[model samples]
Target: METRKGLKPALVAAAVAAAFAAPVEARITKIEITSRGPAFGGVEFPGVGAYERLVGVASGEVNPASSNNSMIVDVNLAPKNARGNVEYKFDFYILKPVDLSKGNHRVMYEPPNRGGKTFGPFNRTTGGNDPSSTTNPLGQFLAPRGYTMVFSGWDKAAGTNTANFNATITLPIAKNADGTSITGPSYEYIVMGNATTTSYNLNYPAASLTDKSAAKLTRRARIDDAATVIPATGWDFVDANSIKLLPDGTTFAANDIYEFSYVAKDPTVNGLGLAAVRDWNSFLRFNVTDDSGTANPLAGDVQKIYTYVLSQPGRLLNDFRYYGFNQDESGRKVFDGMLQWIAAADGLNLNLRFSQPQRTQRNRQDQLYAEGIFPFAHQSTTDPLTGKTAGRYDKCLASNTCPLALEVYSANEYWVKAASLFHTNPAGTQDLADPPYARYYLMSSHQHGTGNGTARGSCQQLGNPLNANPTLRALFIALDQWATNGTAPPPSAIPRLADGTLAAAMPQSGMGFPNIPGVQYTGLKSTRFLLNYGPQFDSGIMTINPPATVAPFFDNPANGKIYPTFVPKTDSDGNDVAGIKVPDVMVPLATYTGWSLRAAANGGPDGCEGSGQMIPFAKTRADREAAADPRLSVAERYGTFGQYMYARGNSIVQLMNQRLLLDEDAYAEYTAGLAAVRAGSLLKDE
Candidate 1:
C-alpha cells in the first residue's frame, strides 16, 4: 500500500506526563462502505467539503486491554485470539476533501453517549433520533477542515437495532475448563411505573435453572432504602434464555425499584465493550491489514485520531484508560487526544460477569456498584480511610500511551456526585494540582437536564436552567488545537479549599444565604466514599449474592475509605464562587445553585438526585419589599439594558483575560447575551 498521507511523528503524551514513545504507525485489512449521504440535512461543513455519512460493519480479533484473561468467557473459545474474532457494525459520518491538498487528513472518533435514548448519538444537540440541521452539538465545525468524523457505540446491553442506536460488538460466551457453565449472582434496579411490569432484563443471563426458586428477587423504594425480599415473586421464562417478572401476589408499587439475584448463566464478556471502541478506532487509524480481517475505512486519508465522549461515553473513556486500553495490542496508541465531559466519578462498569454499562448511580435512587472505586485522579492517591494507594493512570503510564486529555464537569458533580474526591484528599484539603496530561474544568452554575424554574416549587428550590455547553464548545476547539498542533490550552479552573472556593457542604444554613420564603432548602448533598462491595465485586465476580454492601451503605452520614464529601463554597447570594465564572456569575441575573430539590412528582423530595437550581433576583426594590426578599434586587444590581450589558461585557472581557473563556466564545457570547439583555430576557423586569 503506497502512503498518500504523510507519516506524522507519533506525539508522546509524556511531555504532559513523562517518557518518550515510538513514532505512529497504522494498518487495516479493508473497508466495506455500505451507504453514503449528506448529514445534518446538507449543512455544508466549514473546512471540509460536503459530508458523506457511511454505514458498514467491521470485524477483527482483539486482545484484552491487559493480561486480564477473564473478559474471554469460554476457556475453550477460540485459539486464534482467546477473546475471539468478532464483527461489529457501525454507522459513521465523514467528509472527503474536494481539494485533498488543502484538507487536514485527521479523524475524530466521537464515541456514542448511550445513557438511554436521550443521551445516545444522532448528531443532535438535545440528543435523539432527530439530526439537527439548524443546531448540531457534535462539534460539526471540524467537518470543513477535512476531518473524518466517526461514532461507534460501546454498550452491548443496548438494543441491536443499529439504525436507531449505536453499534454493538459480538462477544463470545465464557465457560469453565471442565465445560460446565459458570454462573454468578447479579442484580437489577428497575425504575417503577405502576409495578405491574414484573419482568426486567438481567445484566447477564441468570444461570439456567430447572427450578425458579433458586433465584431470589427483592424490592426497595430506593437503592439505599431498606428492602422487602419478595418470597412470592414469580417468574415466567421468556425462553430458556430469558425470564420475566410474574406479577402474582407481589404488589409491585409504582416508580420503585425491584431487584433480583439469580443463578445467571451466560455471563456476557461486557468488559470487551470498551475494547471494541479502542480496537475499532485503532484499526481505522493505523493498519493496512493483518490476518484479523479489519479493513481500514479511511487509511491513508486519515493521519491523526482524536475521540470525544460526553457524559456516559466519557465514563467509558475513563474505563478505557483505566485498563491501559489506550495502548493497543500492537503497541500503538489509539486516541491521540480525548475530551471527557460530565463523567463525574463514573468509570464504566464493563468488565463484570453480568455487566450492564448503563447502570448510572443517581443519588438516593439507583446508586450502586464498585465502578466508583479507588484511583480516580490521574495521579496516585492514598486513601486515608483505607491506607491503600491507587491511581487511574498506572496502566497508561506503564505503556507510555497516555493521551492528551481534558475533563469538563458541571456543578452537579460536586453537589450530587462524588466528583469532589477527584481533587481532594479523603479527610483533608479540597484542592490538588491536576495531572500533567489532563485538565479539569468545573462549569459553575450549570445543569445538564431541562428545568422549570417555577413550575416545580415543590422541589427544594427552582431548577437551574443554565448549561455549560457554550464553554464546552469553546474548549472543544482548544483541545483540537492543542492535540493536532501542540497549542497549549487555558489553565484549568476548579474550586480550591486553599482559596476558600471549595469547602465542606451543609444541608441548609451557614453559607450566608438569604431566607427565601416558600423555597425549602434541599438540605441534602450526595455522599461520596470509598466502599467495600465484598471481595469479588471489582473483579466482576460477585460473591455476596443479591447485593453485597458494607454496613454504612444506607447511612446518609457515612464516609468512604479516605474522605467525607466536599462541595464548592458559596457566596452570600447562595451561589458557588469557584470554577469557570461565565457571564451569569460575573454579571448578576439569578443566584444559581449546583443543587435542586426534586419535586414530589420527580424525585420524591428526599435528595432530588443531581439537579441544579436557579433563584432569580427580584426585579426591583419595590418587588423585594413586597416579597420581603432579603437579597439584592436585579434593579439594585443593574438598571436598564445599558447597565446589564456593561457588566456582561466587562465579565466576558475579564474571563477572556483570565483565559477562562476563549476569545471566539467571548465574542459570540457578547453578541448573543447583549441581544438577550436588550430583548429583556436575561435581565428581566419580573
Candidate 2:
C-alpha cells in the first residue's frame, strides 16, 4: 500500500481498481434513525407530521470474502436530468482488521467521497440540512448529502406502515489538490418516513418517501413537588394504661426535645466465623470521616443547624433530614420552599448535634460482651418480710433483660429510642419514664445499619431486605396529624406476643414496665448487666465450649424478693458451713421468674463450661462448628431482639414525657403546631 502520514495513496487507488475489477457482494445488517417532532406522553411521537429537514448520511461497505481478502472500485449514481442522463462520480475502498495475522478480522470505512456533486463525504461537514431554509430544506439537505432515506412498509409485527428506516451508503475518498487522497471519517444517517432508498425505483420518487423534521420543542414538568412537614397537633393516648408518667406531672407532648447517644463497636476478633470488624469500621468511617473525600458537611452539623432552627419559638423543624444512628451515613435534602413554608407557619428555633461515643480500650469484659457470652451470677437482697434465708441460686442471664453492647441493642436502646422520643413523639403527658407521644415504626426487613437494606421506602432502607410496603406514606400522614391537631397517631400494628398479649393504654397511675416481662427494671446496673448476659452472651451458649445449661428464674410471690446461696464444694477436706458441703457466705438471688437461663455447670464434652466457656476461643471444636453453621452464631440469630427492646423503651419514654414534663394545654398546642407543619399547613398564631 502507498503510504501518506503512514497511509498509502497508491495502495488505495489499486484497491479501488481491484474492487471494481471483480463484482463484490454485500448485505444490509442493522439500521437506526431519529426524527424531530413533539414528544408524546409514553410513546416516542405524537401525531403524524413533518417539518423542515436537517442533515443526514447513509453508509455501509462491502464485506470481505474471506479473512484475508481486500478489494475496491469506482462508484457512480445516474439521474435523469432535464438535459438528459447525468452521472455523479464516486470512489470505494476495502479495509481489513489491524491484526490479520493474529486472526482478528473486521472492516471499517475510511474518508468517504470528497467532491463529486457532494461537497464532502459525510453530512456533518457537507452543509446539507439547514433548518433555516424555508423551501425544499429536506431535499437540499438529503440530496446533496447523498442520503438514501427510506420509510417503513406494512409489516405484520408493526401495525403502522410509516416507520422510518436507517440508511447507510459506501463510497471512496477523492484525491486532494496534490493528487494525494483526503482521508475522512465514515458516515451514516436515518430517514424517517419521507426520504428515498436505493431499492426504490427512480421513476417512483414518491414511493421512496422517508420522514424528516426541522425542529421540535420538548419540555418536562415536575409533578410531585411537595414537602414533608412535622405535625403540629400532639398525639393523644386514649388507652391510659399504655404509658407511664413522671413525678413532676409534665407529659410527653408535641415539640418536646430529647437526646440520644450510641456506640457502634467493632465486632469481636474471632479467628473463626464471620467477624464484624469490617462493617463496624465502615460505619465509623461513614459517620466520623468523609470517606467519599468530597468533604461534604457532616450529618452532625446539619442536625445542629436543624436544632437551632427548631429552638426558635413557633418554628417547625421539617426542613432537615437526619441519620448516623448505628453509625450509618444516610439522609436527604428537603425542598427549600418547604423549609420556608415551615418557618413561616411556626417561626423557627431548634438545635441538633451528632453524638459520638468516646472510644475506649477493650477490656476482658468487653470481649466477652461482644461475643454474647458472660458469667452467670444471682445477687440476692434480704427481704424484710421473709425471716428465713430463702434464696434461689440460678443463672438469670438468659432472660431478655441481659445487657450486651451488641449492634442490635445499640440500635434499639439508642437510635430507635432517641429518634422516637425527640424526633417523632408528642409532648405534654404525665409519663416521664416511657413517653407515649411517639409511634415506634420498624421496617419489617431492615438490616443492622440504616440503608443497608432495600431502598424501597424511606432513606433508612438503603441496604438489604427491602420492604415494598406503603407504610412510609402512612407514617407521613400520621406525623402530619400529630403535629397539627394534638391528636397522637396510634401505635403501629405489629404481631402479637407469643402469649397473645396486648399492652394497656397510656397514662395509667402506676409504674409501667417493658412488656419484656421480667426484663423491665429501673436500676441501671441490673438493666445493663441482665441485657448484656441475656442477649449478648447466653444467646451464643450452644456454640460455647462444653455446652452450657439454660435455666429460668421467676419472682417469689410469697417473700416479694430474691435471695441467693453459695454452691456446694465437692472437696472432702473443704470446711462444711451451713450443714451441707457448701460455703457459709450467702450469694444474692432473685425469685424464680418465668425467664430461662442456659449454663454449663460442668465442663461438657465440647470443651470448657460456665465461666471458662465465655473466653475468646477460636481453637475449640465448638467455635469451629459454630463458625461453619450460621444458626449457631449469636449475631446471626436474635440480632434484632435488642432493637425491638429499644423501640419499646422509646415508646414508653415518649408516653411518660407527655404526661409529666410539660403543661397539658401547652403540650397540646405544641403538638398541634407540629401536626399542621407536617400536614403542609403550619399554624401562624402562637
Candidate 3:
C-alpha cells in the first residue's frame, strides 16, 4: 500500500510489521466504520499536522474454553456462534494524525468512564464529550506530541452510542445449559428524591415485578445505620425497571439512602467486555485486517500502547489485570503501560454474574457492593482476614505480560476508597514494597475531583482547591518514557507506617491537625469489611446480594482493628506532610484536607463523599491571633507575594529534579499560584 498524502514514511513500520504478520489467532471477526472525517476541523497541531477521526463498531468472539477466558462467570452458559464461541460487539472512536507515518506510532486507549469520554483530565480541558474538537480541547500535551488517542465501549450499562454518550458494548446474554433465562439476586442503590421527584430507574429488569415477597426495599439514614424495611404496600414498581412511592404526591426525602433488592434475570456475558478491550487492542497492534477484510485503521502505525483510566474505569483496569485479560488470545501483551487516577485499592465487580461494574465503594454510599475485596496490592501479600495468597498482577506476572503500571491517588481516595491497602498489608499493620515494575504516588491534600483555587463552601467546610493536574501531566509523561524506553520514573511517594507521616485517623494529635475555627475533625473514614459472598465467590459467581460482612470493629490482638485504615499526617498548616506536594500544598494559601463532613441539612457528621476541605490562612498575624488559628499567617510565612512565588518556584524546581513536574507545566503552575495569592490579597504591608 502506498503511503497516504503528506505522510513521511519511517522505518518503525518495518520493525513492527513482522509482529503483525506473525499473529496466528483472530477473535475480531468484523470491523464496520460508521463515520470518518478530519478531527478538530483539520486544525493543525504544530509538529503533528491535521488529525483524522473514525467512529466504528468492532465485533468479536471469545473461546470460553480457553484458559484465558475460563475464569469468567457463566461463559459456558452464554449463547455461542456456529463455532461455539461467545460473540460481542463494542463501539470505538479513534483520533490520529491524518498522516500516520509521520506520527509517533504509539496508541493511548482511554476506556470510557460510564460511557462518557474522560480525556479531559489528560487534555486539561472540560465541557463537551465529543473529543474531536476544541469544545473539549485536546490541549497541546497529548496530540501535539504525536500520540494516536483511542476510545472504546466496554460497559453495556453505559447506554447507546451518541455524540454525548458514545463508547458502549453489546454482549450476549447468559442462559442455563437448557437455554432458560438465568435469574439471581440483584441490588439497586438509590439516593432518594426531593418533593417533585417521583421515581428512579433500576439497573436491571426485575424477574417478577409484582411478586412483593421476592423484592425488598429498605431505607437508612446513614451507611452504618440499621436498615428499616419499607412494607411492600408502601411502594410499588412502576415497571420491571423503575419504582416510586405508594401514595400520590408522596415523596422520598432528598439525600437519604434507599436499597432495593429483587430477583433479576438475563445476565449479559459481561466479562466479555474485558475480552473486547483485549482483542481490540490486539487487532490494532498485531493485525492488518479483520475477517471481513476491513483494514486496521492504524495497521502498521502502532508500536507501543498505553491505557489511561480514571475513577470507576480505573478499578476496571485493576480487575482487567486480576482476571488475566492482559494476555490476548494469541498470548501477546495488550497494554505496555497503564496510568490510573483516583482508583485507590478498590476492585471492580465486573467479572461476576449480574456484575455491576459501575458501583464503587464510598464513605457514605455504595459500601455493601463487592467492590472492596482481597488482593488489594499489585504484589502478592497474604490477606490476614481471608488467608488468601494472591496479588492483582499474579496471573499477568506468571504469564510474563505484566505491563509497567502507575497508580496515582488523591487525598480523597484515602478517606473514601481504602487507598492505604495498596501499600500496606491487608491488615494495614505494615507497609509492603511495590515490585520493580510498579510505582504509586499520592497527590497531597487533593480531592477526587479538581477544584479551582478558592475557599467556597460546598459540603460543610470550604471545598479543597488543591488540583493535581500539573503533577499528573508530569507523571503521564514519565509513565510513557518508562514504557517507551527503559527510563525509570520517579520513586513512589506515599505515607509510610514506618515513618510518622502515616498516622491513625482518630484524635487530632495523631493527624497533627491544628484547631482551625469552624472546621471539625472527626477522623471519619470509609472502613472495609470481609464480606461473605457464598462459596462460589472464588469462581466469580456472587450468590449473595448485599453480602453479609464481619463486624466493622474488631478486638483482634495483632492489629486491634479490622482492615485498619490510616490517613496522611498533616503539617501545622494542615497540608499533607508526605506524597508529591503540589505547589498549593508546598507553598500554602489555605489548610487543605482530604476529608470533608456533610452539612447538617444533608446528613450530619458523616463524610461528604469524595470531597476535601480548603480553609484559607489568615492574611496577617493579627487575623490569625483574632481567629485563634495555631498556624502562622500567610504574611508571617512569606512576608511578600514575591517571596511566596520564589518559594513555590524552588519547590517546582525540586519536583522537576525528581521528574514529578514537567518543564512545560511549571509556567502554568507559577501563573496560577501568583493569581491565587493576589486573589487572597496576601501582598506585603497591604
Any runs in candidate 2 off by more than 4 Å, and if so which?
Answer: 1-436, 449-464, 468-470, 492-527, 530-686
lDDT of 3 by residue, 1-686 (tens): 12223333454455356345553433788999999998887788766788998998899988788887887788889888898888899899898998886677778898898888876756776634677766533465678878898999999888674756388999889888888888888888877535467787887778887687877787777666766778888899899888887785567768777887789989888888888889899888877788767788888667778887778888989989888889987777899999888888988888888888877778887755887888889999998786789999999998999989889999888888879999998887899887988999988998887754444443787777777777777888888888877789999999999987887786887688888888888888887767666677777777665422112212233223357778888887888999998887888888888778988777667778877888888889999999999989999999888889899999889988998888888888888888888777887633
Instruction: Give the Å error, residue 163, model 1.
Output: 2.5
Q: Which ten residues in a row have the lowest lDDT in candidate 3?
A: 547-556
Q: Candidate 3: where is the Cα deviation over 4 Å?
A: 1-26, 135-139, 193-195, 452-458, 545-561
**lDDT value, residue 315 of candidate 1:** 77
User: How large an RMSD does model 2 have?
Assistant: 36.5
Candidate achieving higher TM-score, 2 or 3: 3
**lDDT (0-100) at residue 592 of candidate 3?**
86
- List candidate 1 stretches off by more than 4 Å: 1-31, 40-47, 63-101, 115-140, 193-198, 208-214, 222-225, 233-251, 289-295, 427-430, 449-462, 546-562, 601-603, 659-668, 671-686
lDDT of 1 at 574: 73
Estimate the TM-score for candidate 2: 0.16
- Residue 111, model 3: lDDT of 89
Residue range 1-686, candidate 2, lDDT tens digits: 11112213443453334323322222111122233221111121112112222122212222322111111111111112342321121111111111112111111111111111111111112322122222333322222212122111100111111222211122122233454432211110111122221111110011111211111111111111121211212111122112112222334322111111111111111110000111111111122222222221111111100011101110111111111111111211111111010011111111101100111001111111121101111112233322322111111121211111101101111111111111111221111121232233322212221222212221211122211112222233233344434455544322122212111112211112122211222111111111221222222211111001111111223212321111111111111111100000011000111111111121111110011100011222364364542112222221333432333344334533433111222333334323423343211222
Global lDDT of each model? 0.62, 0.18, 0.80
- Best candidate (score: TM-score): 3
lDDT winner, 2 or 3: 3
